[model samples]
Target: MCRLLVMFVMFLIPAWALGAPIEIAGRATVVDGDTLAVNQKRVRLWGIDAPESAQQCADPHGKPWPCGRRAANALDAWLQGRTVRCVQRDVDRYGRSVAECLVQGDSVNAWMVRSGWAVAYREYATAYVGAEQLARTGKRNLWQGAFQMPADYRRAQRAMQGEDTRAARVPPPGCRIKGNISSAGARIFHLPGQRDYEQTRIQLHNGERWFCSAEEATAAGWRAAKR
Candidate 1:
């Protein structure tokens, strides 16, 4: 009887914890690619970043309004005029609730990825990476063209805000620059004027300046042209 009671309590605990699904009813206003406001309460979706309304990207017709409008329209179609279920998670840094929303029995995050409107942001490349990979390779939605990666896009935005100072400042040729490490072991330094410069410097200065891949440096607008 005691064992049976323990099992029953264990089962009941989860159900009690879940409780009744609270229904929040409101008109969703898309704040950005991954955020929405429901009746003034901001909610950041689990995974996604739609184009900004002010973003200017040419459409197939060489016209504007395709990228941002398409993102808004997708969200509108998914949730407009319909009730959604929000499984609340922790509050994000922006004070908005991070949540997995459900519309018509579909996971909103999954839907966004499947539709190619958003990418699964896997910092450590978890299961969601597969979905993002497939979406990118399949050229679904935003992946259909030469759109920048969401990470790169965010970096660009932060650069505009003067945050990514390294990328913003152009390093002088033959000068050394410091960089952060990927695994926190050592810093990396970029030394100019060496044949195996990047690799050699990366090995010696394991903790100072990371060897910036050509792509990374280029994205940051750092040119490697000789003096």
Candidate 2:
């Protein structure tokens, strides 16, 4: 009966504790509101999400506010160059350790959420829900204004970047010849050694391209520069 009880206790032990507990401690550098680096190791505050560094929010009057940088500055001032200790809870997809960090015995993660610099990341953990509720009710920091969730903001930014990348034009590899359409509607191809080649710019959106050879350029209805 005693052996069975011991086995049951072992089964209930946390997986992270079953092995050596991962603990990092050092003077911290604030990477953002919910992230810090100690001894050059990145640690993400667990159970909370802060605005991205470039993200913006709206104030009560609907004016744009740099809430992202504000959150980062708030966390930095709160830290005050103190040593931070963090215990690893999990590893995030970005290779950062998701941790519950403490400074002077106070939980940094709870402070961020409670102070409204960050929001409780309900998708991963609900431990800070009460603190978040209190912050919201009190209209602290971000709670006093309108802002998108950090994750949603990141997704929106990524979508915009993807569309921009798709709309951009790039020259093909080894195609050093520039095909330009003059103002007079003449299709001209500039070679590497030609005089105007240095000044010629290919605007792909205006139906320009880089040609691999003069033959190819002429075949595509572009005449070589007279020079």
Candidate 3:
């Protein structure tokens, strides 16, 4: 009877949940240059990495530019309300699907690399190396400027933020909104009394800040915490 019960449970489990390849298709919401949400599930584009939302890059003359936010905006425009189809290749530590996505039959991952908004994530895959080379040679968007690799920038941010995530600094009067950067590098803001609000720490030097209102946070490129 126990063996029969185990078999029944296994039968009820989804193939994808059992480690089969999963594919999701829908209108996607852009989360950043190399991340999107399809059907409310976060998907990280495989084989590429884009800058963080607040990261900056230097132009040819050495002036700082908001390359990270520009990358996200460019990608959003490129999608143009089209449907996205993502095929899962793996799952990241954040539980996000690492996928090779397509829009209008063109590879979104390749496009990001080739357009110079993202770099080939060679640590995981070499499939977009050619695309990266093309972007570099053509001097595409980010290629036109001097920018730290996305991974390196993230590492530097983490190092500067330190291990102490305790919220020791008090917010300004009537400006209690907390802007926090996630381990995944998303800029999310929490309101007072919201879940994670009490626990979220603001590292001012890390580009996290306090906003007086939701609109101010959104305008500054921080999304509201889902919870």
Name the top lDDT candidate. Answer: 3
- Per-residue lDDT of candidate 1, residues 104-208 (tens digit): 787777777777777776652243566677877887777766565556766788766563345324433533443434364433334455444444423222323
- Residues 134-194 of candidate 2 have per-residue lDDT tens digits of 9999988888889999999999988976654443344567788889899999999999889
TM per candidate comes to 0.53, 0.69, 0.68
The parts of candidate 3 lying over 4 Å away from their true place are 1-13, 17-19, 163-227
User: Comparing 2 and 3 by lDDT, which wins?
Assistant: 3
For all predictions, the C-alpha RMSD in Å is: 12.8, 9.3, 11.5
Q: What TM-score would you give candidate 3 relative to the actual structure?
A: 0.68
Ranking by lDDT: 3, 2, 1
lDDT string for model 3 (29-51, tens) is 99999999999999999999999
Candidate 2: clashing pairs of residues: none
* Number of backbone collisions per candidate: 11, 0, 0
Lowest lDDT 10-residue stretch of candidate 1: 201-210
As for TM-score, the candidate ahead, 2 or 3, is 2
Return the clash pairs for model 3, or none: none
